[model samples]
Target chain A: MAVDTRKCVGCSDCVVACQTENSVPIGFCRDWVVEVTDGTYPTLELELRSERCNHCDNSPCVRCCPTGASHYDKGGIVVVTHNKCIGCGACIASCPYDARYAHPDGYVDKCTFCLHRVEKGLLPSCVATCPTKCMYFGDLNDPKSPVSIMLKNRKYKTLIPEAGTKPQLYFLI
Target chain B: MREELIVSGRMNPFIDPHLNIWHWQIPLYLFLGGLAAGILFFAALFYLRGKENEYRAAVKIAPMIVPIILIIGLFALFLDLKHKAYFWHLYTVIRLQSPMSWGAWTLMIITPLSFIWAALHIKEVFPKWDWKYQWLKDIETFFQKYKKVIAWLMAIYSVILGVYTGILFSAFNARPLWNTSILGPLFLVSGLSTGTATAILFSKNHEERKTFARIDLLLIAIELFLIVHMFMGFLASTQVQIDAANLFLGGPYTAPFWMLVVAMGLIFPAVLEALELIKFRIPVYIPAILVLFGGIMLRFILAYAGQMSRWLY
Candidate 1:
């Protein structure tokens, strides 16, 4: 997933869309916007970035799961097997991005990257409903993919690379 | 603290960055697991070294609490599980990378071995109590016949269980406070120290009491050093690690950590145990009780502080 931070307006429409699409609880969210403010008052610079599960290559949540409940699918999307989850919260504690939570129904829940839609060759709900068209979802390995084309010229960065999580989410600044 | 001088790539507002998924039961399980591990290790050690008679309270009574305490710890773990019915899922596969997996396998092996260790000693301690039951007598005979092998196995399992408790926390890399390598040895020494104090509390012989006090004093001193090294490790790492170090130095976690774990738990007990080590005949139970309380509080602080730590970036 690649995001064009230049087009984001901190509107949080995608957040609401995700909640409705995934049936996320009232106080919970699968995705959200992080607004960063910089510079002095007279010359303040505001930046809004959409954030969610990175589906990290070195996902700690999957590594820490005792029952193999938190796992990666064929598309490399990290997901939880609700039935096998003992709800020990080990995966929740191990997630560096704070992307997981103990759902009220006795399972660790996280953003699935809209796996149901992706499996059907459809974009994620947040990517599809985004009014600014800032979000881009495609195989990074495919040279012709929009995400690959965007990364070729745009200056991009991932959050906390020093964590060694190797997050897949990229922000084009 | 000046807001007007904010720079680029500066502070950002992140909503709901913390997850309060774990509760008191997790910490309680860790404490009991460590304590049980300590008791079993020391008991097996005393028996192997031919000091069983000299340290009867430790060798005989310590293993006796192994099965009982671990059962309660497993019960606490069961209660903490959201899908308690699916507890068997933990045994379905083995993920070498997962500390929880290692712990589950370790507990499964140790729990039964611990019971066998206790049963071996039961005949020696209470010869007449189980003689009425034929099956109990036969089981005791079987364990007694293989007592030496059981002692060696218990000794090994006990150490694994003790270190596993600390590894379980340290394995969570997201929690910077628990990510250090020293936590393993720190917890092992604490378990040993607390186990020695418990043995001292139960010892009727002055020599046994004095022996345990001396050992506990040494363990406390080592625990102090390991804690200092833990903070130093944190300070020498990344910004996230430095923030985690501050949790103990001057952050909101400092009060409980210092008051319960350091002062009441290590310092006071160390001083009292030190006095007793020098043949000053102080009240052993007071310091013993304090050590146990402090040990439990240490787990509480570790669990809570670990949750507080995050990738602030």
Candidate 2:
């Protein structure tokens, strides 16, 4: 996933789209918007971007999960097997991005990159519903994919790269 | 200098301010697990050293309580689990890198061993006790024949269980406060100190009490040194770790951690034990209770404060 920060207007349409499409319970979310205001006083800069599970290549959640509940599906998407999860919350603590939450029905919940929809040849609800067309989702393994081209041509950064998670989500700077 | 404000629709309760998923149950479970480790370690250590008769409190009496403590601790853990019915899943697969998996397997092995160890010595603790069935007597006799082998295995597993209680927390690198190697040794020494305290409480022999007091004092000293070393390492490392150390340095956790865990738990108890060693007429229960209190407090403060330490903020 690549988010074009310059184009985001902080409208939160993706947030609504995800909630509606995934039927996420109230007071919980699979994805959300973050508006970062940086700088001193009047010399300020704002960057709005949608954030969700990084689905890191070195995901701590998968490594730390006691059972094989949290594991990588095809295309490197992290998914939780609800029935297998004991809901000990180890994955939630291991996540640097704070992307996972305890589902009320008693399991850890997080973004699956909308694999159900993507399997049927559709974009994720959040990417499909973004009015600004700022969110881009595709296989980074594909050299001609838009995400790969964007990273090649534009400056991009990942959240908390220092943690060494190798996040799959990128923000175009 | 730069500042940032994050305005979002992200309202996940525990994740907003910080990660706060673990609660009293986890800390309590760790405390009880460590305590069980300590008791079993001492029991096996004395048995292997041929001092089992001399340290009856450690080798026999203290172990009698281990099975009970472990069950209560496991119950607390079960209560904390969100998916109670699915806990059997923990045994379905074991992820070696996952501390929780190691913990679950360790508990499974140690819990049964504790019951068997205690049952083997039930006749010694209760003079009139006997096996009601012939098969039960045969089983007891078979175990008693190889009691030394059982003691050796128990000693090894006890240390693993002790260190594992701390490793469970330190394995999570995302939480800076708990992401240190020192926690394993720190928790092990603390467990040993608490276990000695329990032995001291149960022993009626003056010489045995004095012996455990000296050992507990040494263990307490090691625990304090490890704690100071942990903070020093934290302060010398990344900003996030420094923030973690500050939780007890001057942050909101300072009072409870410093006063309760350090002063009351280790220092005061050490002083009392020192006086007792010198033939001072101090009641044994006072220092024993203090050490136990401090052990649990250390877990509580760490579990809560670690949740408050993160890289994002």
Candidate 3:
């Protein structure tokens, strides 16, 4: 739920861990990183951030899905029901984060926050394998949760807040 | 742990790549859908006014397009699907928020209604031929009895079909180029314009030909206005919206948007039609063909520009 961009080394261990853990197809990813630079050459400021399915509060993919293929599961995490997807690509274009993909298996695929592991009381693959311990995941509703405490103590920002998708991911600057 | 700004403008080690999902199938579907809707709407309008007997060629050709082009369009859409076999899932449930749902249901209804619309005029299709089957005659008689209702339904659904093409793209909120509400009317007017052009090209009667030419000119003018409004609406919204406007203003899509969709599709046709309306008598087919070409180009350009206008990396 919360990430410290200041701590991300851009090693991409999390991306590799995710691909292996979720069996993401080659040349595709469930999570990735973005490196942006601002200002002039002599005084350039660089920012390294991991990006993936925002799992937004108001997910456009779910709303635009005609067959209920994409929907919100328990814990308010967005997911896809593979059998129901007609591979119309409507959800692919509808996602504000550009997170969803038309998997070769005839359905849309994206980050589920590792729901299979989460249900068994395990951290997401990205969080679990993050060597720098920069990735944090916990229910924001629980006051004592690590993500909640991090949010309380740190200044954070979300990507593309203007679009109004209300992304669950946070970057601790 | 600690990190530093190691280098200026360093590319992200992770690549969140762009996927080219919707191909020619989508644009072709949109074009054929608009064309079919336009033909039915115009023909049904003429029939309702009791002038169906006048524009013989337009009337005869129009109803035929509804079934033929619609099947082809639906086929193109089906081919684009990765789960082509699971397409039935779209029909089993209704999601009110989905434009695709509205489109699928409307197409189902329109296909049969269009077939009946053509069947009601069986005598026109074969003027001297006698029916070999009594059941066929009974079906035609039944359609004739409800011809007025059928005409109205066809007209109404044609507009829905035309506008639905625009709503389909406009529903993609993540794509700044397509998220505006104006796209619906812009596409509808474009459909009507193309339909009128097709009518002009095929109308056997001079009066019908002139009427369509005049109407098409007016539609072209409105279409130009809407195109301008579409960009202005985007430019007025947000930074992302402004960027969307810039995509046409001077971005990669500028050449096609201006050259194909604008100059060729709208302005050139408008000039030709205006000349025809003033009795200059330029060949009707030239402008008619231009309009049709422009209509298809518009759909293609919109599809590409919309998908390119993503909100994230």
Candidate 4:
């Protein structure tokens, strides 16, 4: 996933789209927007971007899950098997992104990159519904994919790279 | 330079304020698990050293409550699970790198062994404890025959259980307050101190109480040293880790952690125990109760504060 920070306007259309699409319980979210303001008044800078599970290449959540409920699917997307999860919250604590939440139905819930839609040959609801088209989703493994091309053409950074989870989400600067 | 992050559409209850999924249940469970492990470890150690007759409280009396403590601790863990029905999944596979997996398996093995170990000594504690069923009698006899072997196993598993209670939290690399190797030893020593305090409280003999007080004092010393070392490690590490150290230094957790856990729990009890050791008059129950209080407080502070410590703003 690639988020063009310059293009995102903090509209939160994607957040609503995700909630309506995924049936995420009210008061909880799998994805959200963050507006970062940096520097002094005259030289202040603002960056708005949507954030969700990074689906890290070396995900600590999957490694720390006691029941193997958290595991990587094809394309390195992290998914949690609801039935297998003991809802221990080990994965929740292990996530540096703080991307996971305990569902009211008693299981850990997080972004799956809309795997259900992806399997059906569609973009994640958040990406598809973005008003500004700032969020890009595609196979990072495929060099020819739009997300890969965007990464190659732009300066990009992953959040908290020092955490060493090798996060897959990229923010195009 | 100033920076501010205003996040919208970020209302996940626990994560929004801080990581708060683990609450009282986890800390309570850890304290109980550590206490049970401490009691079991001391019981096995004293028995193996052929001092069971001298340390009857440690070997017999204290262990008699282990089964109950463990069951309560397991219940606390079970309650903390969101999907309580699927807890059986914890046993279906083993992930060696996952400390929670190790903990689940350790609890499984040790819980049953604790019952058996306690059951084996029941007859000694209560001479009238007759096995009404023939199968029960046979099981007791079988355990008696291999009591020493069980003691050895319990000793090893108890250490694992004790250290594991702490390792479970420390395993989360994301939480800076808990991401340290010292937590394992710190928790183990604290468990031993609390366990010895319990034994002292139960012992009717002055000599037995004196022996446990001395051991408890030493364990408290080691615990304080490890805690100081942990703070130094945190302070000397990355900015995030230094931020974690500040939680106890002067952050939100300072007073409770310093007053309740360190001063009231470890230091005050150590002083009382020391005074008792030096022939000063002090009630055995005072320090014992204080140590036990401190043990649980330590877990509560760490669990809560660890959740609050994170790399991301």
Compose the digit string of candidate 3's lDDT tens values, residues A28-121.
7788777777777678777888777889998889989989989999888999999999999898888877777777788888899999999999
- Fraction of native Cα contacts reproduced by each candidate: 0.51, 0.69, 0.50, 0.83
Candidate 1's clash total is 0
DockQ comparisons of all candidates to the true complex? 0.49, 0.73, 0.49, 0.79
**Per-residue lDDT value at A172 in model 2:** 97
Model 1 ranges off by over 4 Å: B1-17
Candidate 4 scores a chain A TM-score of 0.98
Q: Residue B237 in model 4: shift from native, Å?
A: 1.0
DockQ of 1: 0.49
Query: B1-313, model 2: which lDDT tens digit per residue?
Result: 4444445567797687789899999999999999999999999999999998899999999999999999999999999899889999999987898999988998989998999999998899989997899999998889999899889889999899999999998988899999999999999999888899999999998889999999999999999999989999999999889999998889999999999999999999999999988888999999999999999999999999989988874
Q: What tens-digit string does per-residue lDDT give for candidate 3 at B192-227?
A: 888887787767678888888888888888999999
Residue-wise C-alpha lDDT for candidate 4, range B1-313, written one tens digit per residue = 7464646647687787789889899999999999999999999999999999899999999999999999999999999999999999999999998999989999999999999988988988999898899999898988899999999999999999999999998888899999999999999999988899889988998988999998998899999999999999999999999999999898999999999999999999899989889999999899999999999999999999999999897
Residue pairs with colliding backbones in model 2 are none
Best by DockQ: 4
Ranked by DockQ, the better of candidates 2 and 3 is 2
C-alpha local distance difference test of each model: 0.85, 0.91, 0.85, 0.93
Interface RMSD of 2: 1.4
